[model samples]
Target: MTSITIRNVPDEVHRALRIRAAMHGRSTEAEIRGILEQAAKPEGRLKLGTLLNSIARDAGGLSDAEARRFDKLRDRAPAEPMRFE
Candidate 1:
C-alpha cells in the first residue's frame, strides 16, 4: 500500500475532522476515505423534469403548480444569521 501525508492543515480544520471522525466511529483516515468516495461520485446529469419528479415522489407526489409554489416559497425564505447569540 502507498502512503501520503497532508501538510500545512489549519488547526481548526484538523480539529473539526477529528471530531467528525469520532462522531461517526471511524479513524480519521477512514473518515477521509469516506469523504473522498462521496466527493468522487459522478455529478448526476438528471433533467429538470426528472429531478422534480424524483423530489415529488419522495414528498408523496406534489402537482406541478404545487411544486412551483414550493420553489417560490423556498426562494423567498430568509437566510439565517451566520452566528446566533
Candidate 2:
C-alpha cells in the first residue's frame, strides 16, 4: 500500500477534521482515508429515459393520448434562435 503526506493544513481545518473523526468514532487518519476514498470514487450515472420510465411506472403509466401528444410536441420544428449581437 502507498502512503501520502498532506502538509501545511491550517489549525482550524485540522481541528475540524479531529472533531469530525471523533463524531464518526474513527481516528483522524481513518477519517481522512474515508473522505479521500469517497471523493475519489466515481458516481453512478443515471439515464434520463430510465429515470422517467421508473417514475411513469410508479405513477401508473401515461395515457395513450398523452404519449401521442408528447410525440407530436417532440416532432415540432426547432424554436427561433436568439441573437447575442
Each prediction's TM-score versus the true structure: 0.45, 0.50
Per-residue CA lDDT of candidate 1, range 1-85, in tens?
5676989999998899999999999998999878876787636756566687668768888877877676666544556869876
Per residue, candidate 2 scores C-alpha lDDT tens digits across 1-85 of 7899999999999999999999999999999999998877636657565577567756978765765566566635556889999
Worst 10 residues of 1 by lDDT: 41-50
On lDDT, the candidate that comes out on top is 2
**What local lDDT does model 2 show for residue 80?**
88
Question: Where does candidate 1 stray beyond 4 Å?
Answer: 42-85
TM-score of 2: 0.50
